[model samples]
Target: MSIDITANDFLMGGGIKAARFDTIGTTVGGPITTQPKVEQQKDLDTGELKFWNDGKPMMQMVVTVQTSLRDPEVPDDDGQRAFYIKANSLKAVREAVRRSGAKGLDIGGTLTLTYTGDGEQKARGKNPPKLYSATYQPPAQAAANEFLNGGQQPAAVPQQAAYAPPAAPQPPAPAPAAPTAPAAPWTPPPGMTPEQAAAVAALPPEQRAALGFA
Candidate 1:
């Protein structure tokens, strides 16, 4: 008998880091591999567990996601990296998932958390709490062509030209001007003898007017 083991199994032993939102505009995200769970909160300064005034332990939600993003402070570290979500950040993530139409956060989907800004300070000498927003992207659905072709790719469809209105009708060209004829040369008046007209034509302008032949 043979047993199978992978590098990921070994990498999981290194433990996952809780995502940080120490500064405004900080963003962290990746595909989720584990679902959210409520866990007891621990004191950051003493490394000890914490409890409420009523004797119940304070708790927070933990989620594990696989990411390739490297921490700037640990640039040399090149191993499988995971991040855990907690507290109010978990509420933001849940709201994002719900808005995306998902029933709940599921494995193989991406969840991005961003620190937007600080909230109002509630008391003196205490810093304001960081505010966050989240976005969830569900896994991509299979295309219709893939299903119809039994997982084979379909040929590309040709693009059609967009519809355009026909151009306005152009006015008909103006009709060519009718051909014109030249005027005839001046002729002698009716009842006037040609010889008399010739004599009138030879006379000076004042004499012609005196003879009534102007």
Candidate 2:
């Protein structure tokens, strides 16, 4: 295994950071969107492309977006920031759009990205915590009006519907209870005399029950 540094190695060593925002709100101005590019790598020493452990080309689809920070107090790079969606989050965004009935995303159209985390991703500063989720916010008329009225903020984009998981199957309904049958009148045991049977029958139901006669 040979390793060598490229002339642009210094420029390629930076990490991606999440846009700092106070709330989950509409991004200012529509984004300059780009299609996901397939991930690739080259060996600095051999100048050969690398493949995955399975002998297949290691590839990834990334959706990169740049938008304004909603919160004025939130710090951004030159008043804006770029977000990267890859791996599972990328799949989630695509599924979300499909469920919303949109064929695809349009460049310069209003879109919003929101973040949620349980602190694990937040702890790693290399990448914005993988978006808990991403959404396509459609531009609204009122938002357009506000944008045209000298406001830097554009009209609010309406969020597409999120993907809903299918409901789990319910347990099969319980079987119907067996029907009850009427009890026959009690009869005297074998060889019992008429008087004996009458006396036995005259006893309280509890007493007769104790005698095993119903």
Q: Residue by residue across 1-214, what tens digits does model 2's lDDT show?
A: 1123355542343333344444444332234354323344555589587787998864433334554434455454443344444455556567756654556554433444554542245544544443345556432221222234433432233456999855667766669989988867766555544644565566566556544444
After superposition, which runs of candidate 1 have C-alpha atoms over 4 Å from their true positions?
1-14, 72-84, 140-214
The ten-residue window of minimal lDDT in model 1 covers 140-149
Predict model 2's lDDT versus the native.
Answer: 0.47
Note the residue pairs that clash in candidate 1.
Answer: none
Best TM-score among the predictions, by candidate number: 1
Could you tell me the lDDT of residue 122 within candidate 2? 52
lDDT of 1 by residue, 1-214 (tens): 1123343542343456666667799987776666444456677889688898999987655556666667678766443334444556767877897887767665556777889988889999988877789988653211121122343333343456899855667766769998888844434445444533454455555444343333
Task: Give all candidate RMSDs, comma-separated.
Answer: 37.1, 30.2
Model 1: lDDT to the true structure? 0.58
Tell me the spans in candidate 2 whose CA falls farther than 4 Å from its real position.
1-30, 33-36, 41-51, 70-80, 118-131, 138-214
Best model number under lDDT: 1
Clashing residue pairs in candidate 2 are: 143-155
